[model samples]
Target: MSRFFSSRYANAEPYKPGEQPKGQTVVLKLNTNENPFPPSPRAIAAAAEAAGRVNIYNDHMCRDLKAAASEYFGLPAENIMFGNGSDENLDFAIRAFADDGFPLIFPDITYSFYETLAGLHSLPQVVVPLAEDFSLRLEDYRGLKGMVLIANPNAPTGLARSRAEMEAFIAEDPERLVLVDEAYVDFGNESCVPLVSKYDNLIVTMTFSKSRSMAGARLGISFACKELIDDMEIIRNSGNPYNVNSMTSAMGAAILQDDEYTRKNCAEICRVRGWFSGELRALGFNVLDSRTNFVLARTDKIGGKELYEALKARGILIRHFNQERIKDYNRISIGTEEQMKLLLENIKEVLK
Candidate 1:
C-alpha cells in the first residue's frame, strides 16, 4: 500500500478484466466476449480521417455522435449521452441517482462491476439472488426502494428478461431509478431504449464494443428522459467533458450510419452461437441458452478450472470464475465457426 493512496479506496477491490495475452502469442482469445468480426469499413475510414485532426480539441459535447445516435435510436439529441464506454455511463448513473443511505440493487450473479461501482462510490448495495435455474427472479426485486441496475441478456449466464417485463418493473415505482445495460442486446435481446421516453426514471445504456466491433474505439451511448440526461451531463461534464475522443465519436457515428454491416455481423454471431451451443450440449455439457455472443457451460467429464487450463494449453482461451455458485462453469465467447470447431476438438481430447 502506498502512503499517498486515498483512504477512501483502501477497502475497494478493483475489477479484474479478462486476460489479454501480450506480444502476439497467437492465442485464440475467447474470454473477453469481444466481437469476432471486424469494425465496419465506414467506421474505420471515419476513424482514419479523424486521426488527422488530433491536434485540435474534440467537440467535448460529441454533438455529431449524439445526432447520429439520436436518429438511429429514435431519440432526441437532448436525450442521448456519450461516455468513454458503457462502464462510464453506468458509473455516472450510479453517481447521479444513488444515495449513500439507499442501497444499489442488482442480481448477485450478474455483471460483477455493479459491486465494484457501489464500493468505489462508498454506497450501500444489495444483491438479489438469481433463482435455482439461474434465471433472474423479477418478483424478488419488487417493492425494493433502492436504485436498480440490470445487465440485459445478463453476462456470464446470458439469460434475459423481456422488454415488457422490464417496463412492468420500472412502472411499479416511478420514484426509484432503474438503469438497464444493453451492452449485449444487439445480438438477440429486445432493447428497452424505446421505453426511455415513457419512463422518466429509466436509463438505457449501449456500447459499440460488442455489436459494432469497436472495442478499441471505447464508445458507449445512453438514452433517458431530458431531465435525467441533464442531471447526468452535470456529473459527466464535471468528471470528463471530453470523455469520448474525436476518433471514437466519429467512428461510433459512422458505425450507426452503417447499420447493415452491424446487423449482418450480429446475425452471424447469433447463428454461430446456436450451432456451437448445440455442439457443446451434444458433448454432455450443460450449456445455458445464451442471447449474447457467448455461452456458459459445464460438464461432468472435467472440472471448470481443469478445462480452462487444458484449453489455454491448447491455445484456446475461455473464462472461468472462482465464485462458489458458478465455479464449475466456463464462459466461451462465440468466435468464428472454425474457431468453435477447433475448440470442440480440443475439448474432446481433454475429456478423453
Candidate 2:
C-alpha cells in the first residue's frame, strides 16, 4: 500500500478546507467564502444547454473559454491559461516557478493554502509576518531571496496592497517572478493584469469562485508573458489534457461574458459588507476594514472558538481559526441582506 501512493503525497499535510455537513438540514453555510446569490441566470442556462456535452471530450486547449476571457481582458488568447479552478492554477504556479531549492515566501497569516502547497511540493518556504494592522509590508518584499507569492486583498485579513505600491516593487526588482493572486480583485482595487503586457516576470491568477459566484464551477486562470503561459501549458499537458470539461468551458465562457452580473453582485456585497461591519460594531465586535466579500472581526467578551461553536449550535456557520493571532477573530462571508439579518440576530443571542 505504501508503494502504491506517490512518495510526495504519502506524508503530505493537505490543506484542511471548511466542512460541508450533509447530515444536518438546519445549516447556514458561511464557513466557506461562497456567495449566497445564485450564479448568473445566463450561465446556469448555458450549463443546462450543455448537459449533453458529456458525450464528447472537451477541447483539450479550452478554446471557447480562452476567447471569452481574452475578449473580457482585451488580451491575446495565447497569454491566458484556464484550470478546473484557481487552485489548479496555483498548483501550476508551485510546479512551474519555484523549485525545492528556491522555496516560496508569503505572509505567515495569509491563505493557509500556501503552506499546504509548500509542504506538498517540498518547496523551501520563508513566512514573513504582516504589520500590526494585518496589512502586508510591500517594502519588505524588495529583495526576494526567492519567488514571492502574495494575495492582494489578502484572505482572512482582507487588506490589500495598492497598484502604485505593487508597481514600485516590480520596478525595484524586475528579475523575480511576482505571482499575484487576484481572486478578489473585482470586489475592489485595480488588477495587475494590465501590467502583464509590459512585465514578463509578472503572473496574476484569478478565479470565478469569488466575484463571479461560481465556487462549485472550479474555474481558475492566470495571465503572464507568452513564455510563462507556454511553460505552464507544458506542465498542464503532461498532467490532464482536459483540465476543464466542455460543459464547464461553456459555463465559464457564459459567466465571463456577463460582466454586468459579476459587477452587480460585487457591488451588493461591498455595500452589505460595510453594513454588516457597522452592525457588528454596534454589537461590540471589532471588524477589520474589508475590501473583499468577507469580514474579519473579534469580540472582546468571548473566545473565538467559543463564539464559533455557539454560532454552529444555533444553525449559523462562520469560520474561526485555531491559530494564535487569528483565533481571536471570526472570518464571516457576506451573504444576502436578509441572510445577514438572521446571522446578526443569531449572534446577538449567542453573545448573551
Candidate 3:
C-alpha cells in the first residue's frame, strides 16, 4: 500500500476488467462482452461531424441524446439520464442512494462492479446467493430492506430472470429503490424499461456499448421516475456536468435513431451464441443457457484455468474468473461465424 494514498481508499480492492491486448497480431478477443460488429454508419458519420466541434464543451443536459432515447423507448426526457458509461450511472446510484445506515443488496454471482461500488462508497451490503443453477430466486429477496441492484441477463452467467419475476420483486418493496441493469437485454432478454413508468422505484439502465457497437464511445442510458432521475441529475451535475463527449453524444443519438441496425446485430450474436453453446456442449462442456451475447461453460475434461491458458496460447482470448464456485467456468463472448469457427477449430486442437 502507498503511504501517500488516502486512508479511506488505501484498503479498497478494485475490480479487474478483461485484458486488452496490444500488438500487431490479430487477436480473437472474446474476453470482454463487446459487440464484434462495427457501429452504425450513420452514427460513425455523426461522430465524425461532432469531432470537428472538439473546442466547445458538450451539452451537459445531453438533450438530443435524451430526445432520441425518448423516441426509441417512448419515455420523456425528464425520465432519462446519460453517463460516460453505465458504470458511471451505477456509481452515481450508489453514491446517491446507498448509505451506511441503509445497506445495498445484490446477487453474489452477478457483476463484480456492485461489490466494488459498495466498497468505494463504504456502504454496507447484503449479497444474496443465486440458486445452484445460477438462477435468481425472488423469494430470497422478499424481505430485504435496502436499495437493490441486479444485472438482468446477468454477466458471467448470462442468465435472465423473467420480467414477471422482476416485477414481483419490485412490487415486494415499492418504497426501496431497485436498479436493473439491462446492458445485455437487446440480445434476447425481456427488458424492465416499460416498468419504470408503472413503478416509480425502478431504475433501468442500458448501455450503447453492447448493442450499438459503441463501446469506444462510452454512452450509457438510465430510465426512472422523473423524481429519481432528478436526484441522479443532481448527482451528475455535482460531478462532471459534461460527462459525455460531443462525439459520443451525437453518435449515441444517431445510433438510437436506427433500431434495426442494433437489432440485426443482436440477432446475429444470439444465433452465434446458440451455435457456439451447442458446439461446446457436444464437446462434453457444461454450457449454461444464456440470453446474452456470452456463454459460461466448463469442461469436465479440463479445468477453467487450463482451458483459458490453452486458448490464450492459441490467441483465442476468453474470460476465466478465479472466484469461488466459478473457477471452473469460462465466459466466452459470441463473435462472428468465422471467429467462432476459428475458436472451435483451435479448441479441438487444444483438447487433442
Candidate 4:
C-alpha cells in the first residue's frame, strides 16, 4: 500500500461496473444492458480508418463530431456537447449543478451509480422513494429547491414518465436545473432533448451504448440551451479537453448518421422484449412493463439470488440486485432472439 495516497480517495467507493470476466469460457452476457448486435457498418469502417490517426492528438474541441450530432438533432452546435461516455456526462452534470451547499435529488432505487457519485464528490444526496411498482413520482421533485437528476425510461425498471406529466412539471416550476439521463431512450420512448429549446433549465443526456451498439466506443451527447451547454463545457474543459478521443468521435459521427440501422436494431430488441416478457409470465413470473431494452422479472417460487447463480452456472448471466426491496426480482437484458430462447429453455431446467 502507498503511504502517499490522496486523502480524497481514501474513503471513496467507486461505481461497481457489471462484471466483464476475461479469459473465462464465453457466457451469454445479459448482465449489462448492452445491445446484442453489431455497430453500424459505417462505424466499424470509421473506427478502422481512425486507427491510423492515433499518433496525433485528437481535436480537443471535437468539432466535427459535435457538428454531425447537431445536424442529426436539428440543433445548433453551440447547444450540443459530447463526453467519453454517458456516465462521465452524468458525473459532469452533477458537478455542474449540485454540490455540498445544494443537494441532488433522484429515486432511491434508481441507478446505483448516482449514490456512488454522491460519495465521490463529497456531496449530500436526497433519495426519494419510488412507488410500490418502481415508478418515479415527479411530484416529489416539484417545488424542491435543488438540482434534480432522472434516468428517462430509467435503468433496471425500464419504466418512463409520460411526456405530458413532465411538461406540466416543467411549466409549474422552472427554477432548479433538471437533467434527464436518456441512456435507454432509443428503444421505445420519447427523448426530452426537444424540451431543451423551450426550457432553459432542462438538459438531456444520451448514450450510443444501447442503440448504436457502441458500448466499447463510449460516446455521450447532450442538448441544452447555450447557457447550460456553456456551463457543462466549462466543467468538461477544465476536466478533460479531449474526453471523446479520435476513434470514438469518428465512430460517433458515423453512427449518428446511420438512422436506418439504429431503427431496425431497436425494433428487433422491442419485439424480443415483448416475447420474452410473455414467456416469463407463462412460466409464472411477473414481468414489469418495460419500454426500454430490458425486463424486470420475479418468479413466484424462485428467489432472485438462487436463479442468478443457477443461470450463471449454466453460462448465462443476468442482473440481480441484492437489496431487500428488489431481491426477489432479476433485471434481465433482452438478448438476441436465439440467446433469449436459450435463456427460456435453460431457466426451465434451473427452476426444476
Indicate which candidate wins on TM-score. Answer: 1
Which candidate, 2 or 4, has the higher lDDT?
A: 4
**Model 2 per-residue lDDT tens digits across residues 1-352:** 6667888664468888987876766558887889878889999988888787678788989898899999999899989999888989998878988886677989978888888888888888888889888889977766666678889889989888888888777667777778899988887878888888988878899998989888998899899989999999988999997899877788899998888988899999999988999999999998888888899999898889999999888777888899887999999988888889999888888878
Per-prediction TM-score: 0.98, 0.97, 0.98, 0.97
Please provide, for model 4 over 131-200, each residue's C-alpha lDDT reduced to its tens digit, 9 standing for 90 to 100.
9989988887766776778888888789998667676766677787788888999888887877888999
Distance from true location, Cα of 154 in model 2, Å: 0.1
Error of 1 at 169 (Å): 0.6
Model 3, 286-341: lDDT tens per residue? 99999998999998888999999999987779999998989999999999999999
- List pairs with backbone clashes in candidate 3: none
- Report how far residue 167 has shifted in candidate 2, in Å: 1.4
List candidate 1 segments past 4 Å from native. Answer: none
lDDT of 4 at 284: 97
Q: Which sections of candidate 3 miss by over 4 Å?
A: 23-26
Question: Each candidate: RMSD to true structure?
Answer: 1.0, 1.3, 1.1, 1.3
* Cα shift from native, residue 66, model 2 (Å): 0.8
What tens digits encode model 1's per-residue C-alpha lDDT throughout 1-352? 8899898886577889998886646468899999998999999999999999999999999999988988899888999999998999998888998987678999989898889988888888888999998998888988888889989999889999999999999998997788999999998999999999899989999999999998877988889999999999999999889999999999999999999999999999999999999999999999998999999999998999999998888778899999989999999999999888888898999999
Clashing pairs in 1: none
